[model samples]
Target: MKVYEALAAAFVEEGTTDVFGMMGDANMFWMNALAQRGVRQYEVRHEGSGLGMADGWARAAGRPGVVTTTSGPGVSQLATSMLVASRARTPLVAFCGETAWGDQTAAQYLDQGRFAAAIECGFVHLSRGDLAEEVVQKAFYLARTESRPIMLSAPMDIQQHEYEDNGPYVPSTQLIDRPRLLPDPSRIERARDIVAASKHVVIIAGRGARGSDAGEQILRLQKRTGAMLATTLQAKNWLYGDTDYHVGISGLFGSRVAMELLQEADCVIAVGASLNSYTTEHGYLFPEAKYIQIDTAPNLVMGNGAVADCYIQADANTGLAELTASLERESVTIEGFHTQEVRRRLTAPLIDPSEFRSQPDLLDPREAIVVLDAELPPELDLVLGSGHQTDFGTMLFQRSREITSNYGMFGAIGQAPLITIGSIVASGRPAFVVEGDASFLMHLSEFETAVRYGIPILVVVMNDQALGAEYHKSRAKGLDVDLAVIPTPELGRVAQSLGGDGATVRTTDELRAALAEYVRQPRPTVIDVRITRDVLSVPYRRLWFGEDV
Candidate 1:
């Protein structure tokens, strides 16, 4: 049996139903073999695009994702998406080809291990054909357990070698048994005591708490304890309902009420949350809250103002369930903890009641967000760019009851267009990519990938005609704002020229009319919305208006 063939078979044995990649000399044989074996193969335009697809598929499917790319430049193309996946804590296995063993003279030859390490991705090289099975299995294990991307480097020579078949392949579950660590009873008791005693409690869930089905239990606990409910940006809609007293997002992009409520919290039960500086506002948001951190692995060493009064090393679902049951048995109820007034204030939309302050001829970005939030199509997955616009989009785009496809982990501005296209292909769902003009221009060609492949993705370019964040920052610092401002060409026209649907809107009416048709029948579309920069972004607004600051 050929080593590549055996490796492909092993991938199937490990339950990889779909493989994403581009054809290249070093990896083509294995990819072809995998496809021939009835495995679904998605040949993407670029290796990075394929990697982004696999990452999106993994996140949406709740499984490990696989991608194969050739040696050198091919693998290098995966650097950005792989780093994004790693930072997002997505379990992704990238099987990359390497130069033939000891063949440093090859044009595409490069040190694959160093390449992987440079991006902080976990890398494993195949030294011998005999150890292939173990290495493949370890790749999956490391990817899952470590919550990182694993680059499995297979040299062409090694891939073409005759497989030294070993003993029967053990199933993945039996081979690498990850323990489902539950919380200690005494620690649950301690957390329960803390929650019970605190007058104002806030239950904040993060990425680790996602997919745990802990929302119901957390809701029960919140209602019984009179505590408010909130989510970290990554865990948006973790509760999955339009409940009152649910202060939408916490931290930098938080609703003013959410931040205020958190500030008032005497005790906070942070489930599966990293409590990063962004989430905490540099340890300033919840100045009064004593945090009870619940996670599978509790870091004993903490720094940089991580607030963990007590840490429980347990699965989010397990710990939260335990806490709920114990509290119920004790008949703990904070009946008026979250009052009607509080709920009304927290759940209310953040749009200014006063007329939208538009910049004369421009569509107010704030108005766009509010309207998008109100009229967004059901089940639309969001692919948001990283910028001042996203600060609005993240807070306003609330259509999905689960996580959005985008995260600020890598924080690259231009990646969203490609990432959005990849996600639409992988998930087979209609998505909206909210990009600013600067971000949209960076990868204008990737939008063509959507049109070329006929993927149903609507890219909404918030055309503020500037590097919006930097532009606002320069003004804030009393510097020449023009340095950050860059004029943008009409993007909709470009998209239309590429055999796709395109619309440029400057008014709410035009946007609404455009969306009505686009949502009903989502072709590969780009809606270039010219927006005003009158209202400084959420980040800029915080400098002058926020109490947490």
Candidate 2:
């Protein structure tokens, strides 16, 4: 058996059915072998997106994703996407092809191991043959340990070289030390005291707080304690569909009623959330609340100095569960906490009031999402970019549907759509990627991959022709706003050129009709909705306007 065979075998035993990568002359041998051996190989157009697809899939499926790339440029292209995955704290294992050992110094011999190290990624060298199993096992170990992306580079010779299987292989699941909550007694007492004291308490969740075995217990605590629940953008689905308390996202892109609850909170239990600068709205959103922060990582407590009266060094789920148990035993009536009134106040139904009040000719981005939300099948998967579009859509969409966005590390545009593309490929489902003008243009080329893969991805491009968030800021400051504008390529035309079904929708009626037609067709569709520039409003603008400094 060759080292590549062993590597692929390890993946099979580990339960990885799909592998994403771009096949180059350097990696063709191993890639083809893996494909024949039952691992479905996806040959993507760009190496960066290949990495992104795997990362997004990992995020959705709760497992480490596998990506392979050829040497030099192929590996180099993975650097940014890998960093994104790393920053988001996703678990992934990447296999990279390298030049033959003798050609290490050739101009094409860029050190991928060095590249991985630069990002503080766990790196192993399969540059040496016969030790492939050890390196492969270690790569999986590192990936699972910190839930970080690990890159392993195999030299061409090492992959091609044959090896003897000395012993029967056994897959190991060595239990590494899992992150635990410290349960500092005093801090728990303080948190316990805060909850005991406050009449109106809020438990705000972020991405870090989700998916622990303890999450449901925390939700149970919320129910037992009668606390209002809200989540950050990254943690949108953290509270699930219990809309009685789940009031959607908070801060810059938050709901007005959600912000009001946080502002008036007598005690804000910031669980698994960092309480970052945005989360606090630079200190205005929750000025009066005695903040209690809990997370797996203590270093991420953002309101560390001034506001956090109680910092519990425990995983949010564990800590919340412990606190809930204590509270229940003590007969605490953290009860009668319902947000039905808040939802009533916050819900702005978009149904046009008048039959004769002519709708705008250019599509309204908000209305487009409203229609898309109504039209989309309940089971359809959705991936949205981070901006006004996602902010609005997240609030507007049904809570039952699954929504993924780059909310943890929101910037670095053009990446989210690729993430969507990868997710659709990995899940093999009808997925949609919704993006603003700027975000859509960032990786417009990857839509070609959707067409090639026939992923049946319907891309809703909200073509407002500007950096809408900045433009909104410019308008708020009373500055010349057009300076925030951007020149965008005609997305529909580009989609058509790449062999996709494309349509330009101007009116709400046109959009409704286009989306209906788009989804029914047996091809990838890019529906470019020409949106009114004025329709883009920064989240919380409706609530935060005209406050004197």
Clashes of each: 0, 2
- Per-residue lDDT tens digits for candidate 1, residues 1-549, read 999988888888777887878878899888987888898777676788778778777877777889999999999998888888888888889999888998999999989898899988998889898777887888888887787899999999998989877767754556666678888899888888887788898888887787675677677777788877778888875564645667777788886666667788888788877777777788787777778888877563232355477788988778888888988888787754478778677556666646577765688787887777667665787766788877777766655444463657687777777666656656778878788899878767666666767888888889989988888878878989888878877778888998899888898888888788788898998888999877676665886444332
Clashes of 2: 2
Off by over 4 Å in 1: 164-173, 240-242, 300-307, 398-400, 405-407, 543-549
Q: What's the true lDDT of residue 284 in model 2?
A: 78
- Residue 340 of model 1: what lDDT? 71
Tens-digit lDDT string for candidate 2 (224-261): 76777777767765555654667667666665556666
User: lDDT: which candidate is best?
Assistant: 1
Whole-model lDDT per candidate: 0.78, 0.74
Whole-model lDDT, model 1: 0.78
Q: How much is the lDDT of residue 102 in candidate 2?
A: 63
Alpha carbon deviation, residue 414, candidate 1 (Å): 2.2
